[model samples]
Target: MSSNPDNGPAVSRREFDELFEAVRTWGRWPAPGRGAWNRVTADHVRAAASLVRTGTVVPIGRPWDTRPGPDNTRPALHHMSDLGDVEPPEPSAYKDFLGADYHGKSVTHLDALSHLAYRGLLYDGRDARGSVGAGGARFGSVQELGPLVTRGVLLDLPAVLGVDWLEPGRAVHAADVTAAERALGVTLGDGDAVLLRSGRFRRRRELGPWDCGAASAGWHVDAVPLLGERGVCLLGADGDSDVRPSPVEGVHSPVHTLAITAMGVPLLDNLDLEALSAACAGAGRYAFLLVATPLNVPGGTGSPVNPVAVM
Candidate 1:
């Protein structure tokens, strides 16, 4: 996918038709509410027996696995506080000692609102220019995504690509997201969280901290408006969600990252794709998803997630 509208835009009538049809079949559809996050339980999925036409949804997000791995660069870990006196059993045990970096990685983590900011204020409207971006832009933490527990949908693009890596700088447009839903024969809801798989996390772990993406995997900024229109609150991907190319002349993050943050959404990055994607492909279904929030640790940019999706 390329933003070069010169190569032509990504949308197609056939893709849209399939998407529209899938939604039309989803019974008892509800309009998205203010927060737009609702957990999906097995019973609720079974209840949607009314909507099943054919096929299943594959788990399309990445799983976070840690070793004595590298950390993501986002301040907080600048000092590179030394490894603790005691050696932990598993990488996870060292999370807290990871200081702000955590296990040298923040894989499978939820993106906090504090990760980005517009000119001055954060989502909650406090002058971060006066304080830390980690504030709730309020009396406490600046992020509001801690409350996000929504119906998440996985779009397994790499499975369809028959390749491990989705080329870097390639665009995974709004239409491809929809095309995937059609391929799975599922309709997306207004509030659904979209977790994308570009197979970037399969990259070498030796890249050290802040290193992610396999050969190449990233999305385009052009998809933001449509995501906003769809009211998507979270965008989780195996790689960076927005179209920020490394070595850009002058920018911390890509424009879409800033634009989406301005819209008050969080971007979960560097997910593991092996087991999850395989399970979904084997199940031939995309129903049944769960994420526990009791896992959140405030004042951090991201956290590891072991989110499970059932068929």
Candidate 2:
């Protein structure tokens, strides 16, 4: 295994290939699409619904970032589409427009199975070219994983470690995941959405923003095996879910490849988990009802989302 230039954990090409094969779920699900989301059965949603006692709903999505920076390169555009000043016949009216390239550092977005490809194939060994193209995805698009609702487990690593935030380039391991679960008195189960909090936004607010795409604290490759074993349907984090200055050689986003392409699990990226963390801590619980519905764009790979956690 060759180490990344930033001195992150290194997984050799052969090791990555082996890992991919080990966790592959190709043709495992009975249905053709939806992938791991198929695990979220009616029972799972009912159980998750039971957790909403206080009826406290917290939005975990970051605000629409419109400023230009290393993180928000494709800043979201918001402009007044209709100003009532044009014609004041009777009542005043106002309207606005919003647009963004949300698949980046600054926006909270969900990644469908079509977002990643390995060896010219998507999840279920479908040909990337045939399933995905200029129009959108034909196979595992956002439409396939409709309205993800299930139990959400928050692994607040920063809170567990008693730190404001993990430093950049810090790679969270499988051990950390277990430790956080123990510390938070929660257990992950089948069809659960696991959200790892590295306190990236807290650090940025306190110490100023940096190029998260260049270096960020997130899951290393070693953590995926345990998550797969625990049957986590969705994975998310304050960062893009991959430790930047990627650990695997020749692969910039190993977590993305393994989670989406190999295991067929969707990913939630750039979530604002600060408030959710506080709410969980106050409630003395880490699990909640996670409700997220992606925009139903036909053939689209993924969509910008505003996911909510109800305690």
Candidate 3:
């Protein structure tokens, strides 16, 4: 695709609006409410619940390692502590706040909205509604992602391909999931939380944790709606979840940004995938309803979730 040079034509504001209007009219999906929207919503919800309730739940993510940024030294650490006084408190209290950047190991975490922003927008188009954005803070964040309980299905790619790590920019299609289900004799239920294990997580035990801030792996865009139709409310993976590189190049993370961000569902990535995978393989059964809830951090973009399997 050639870049539009300065010589290219420009459209007036009116023309732009006209173009938008035409597109909207030409390709508008009829939301259910216009005709039995309630029934439609109910059907989707039931399907989602059915799929997730019967599938196995595997939490697939890594621990959020906190290290120092340039502004991450001792003095700067005061910000995360939020001490009442401007200056550091007495020596006794100093140690209490020094470790915000080094939480060590903890269970159950949900990424705060402040940790990420979509095209400068927050979850549920909160920014478009003129709401404050996720500023990497977790207190009093986001609305409930609706009660999250469903069948969780795990697609073990490493187990499938007989490799240790999937190559970067790997493409996973709906057919792959279908094949896995057929081989495993498990059909997904509605609202199933599919936990994808790409085997990249095995490195933690092999190489130790990598440097913080590297991007994680994710599924392809084409897989989103297919899962959506099956009533998937959340998709959990072992990688960072979003495949689009930061300052994403002419693309969007439609899987989450469009699916959960706009459609009011949620996605969990960066979880502990290896342990969960081992548990399922040992059980020899891939059917179980999965359940997990992030701390109710209102106005938060996400919460760290230490999900458990209700097998």
Evaluated with lDDT, which candidate comes out highest? 2
Better of 2 and 3 by TM-score: 2
What's the lDDT for residue 152 in model 3? 69
- Cα-based TM-score, every candidate: 0.63, 0.97, 0.61
Give candidate 2's TM-score.
Answer: 0.97
Candidate 2 wrong stretches, greater than 4 Å: 2-8
Which structure among the candidates has the greatest TM-score?
2
| TM-score, ranked from best to worst | 2, 1, 3
lDDT score for candidate 1 against the true structure = 0.48
- Model 3, 194-280: lDDT tens digits are 777776557555755443233334565445556656655456676645442322233435445444433334566556667666766
Q: Give the alpha carbon lDDT tens digit for every residue of 1-311 in model 1.
A: 22343212343334433332332211121311112222333444445443334334334343333333333443233233345555666553222333334322345555555455445554444355554544423322313345444556667787766676565555676677677778876666655567777665554443323344322355544455566567665677766564434222233354333433345455666566556677667667654453424144555544545554444
By summed lDDT, the worst window of 10 consecutive residues in model 2 runs over 1-10
Worst 10 residues of 3 by lDDT: 31-40
Residue 15 error for model 1, in Å? 26
Over 4 Å off, model 1: 1-106, 124-126, 131-144, 203-215, 244-249, 255-260, 292-302
Q: Higher TM-score: candidate 1 or 3?
A: 1
Q: Give each model's whole-structure lDDT.
A: 0.48, 0.92, 0.48
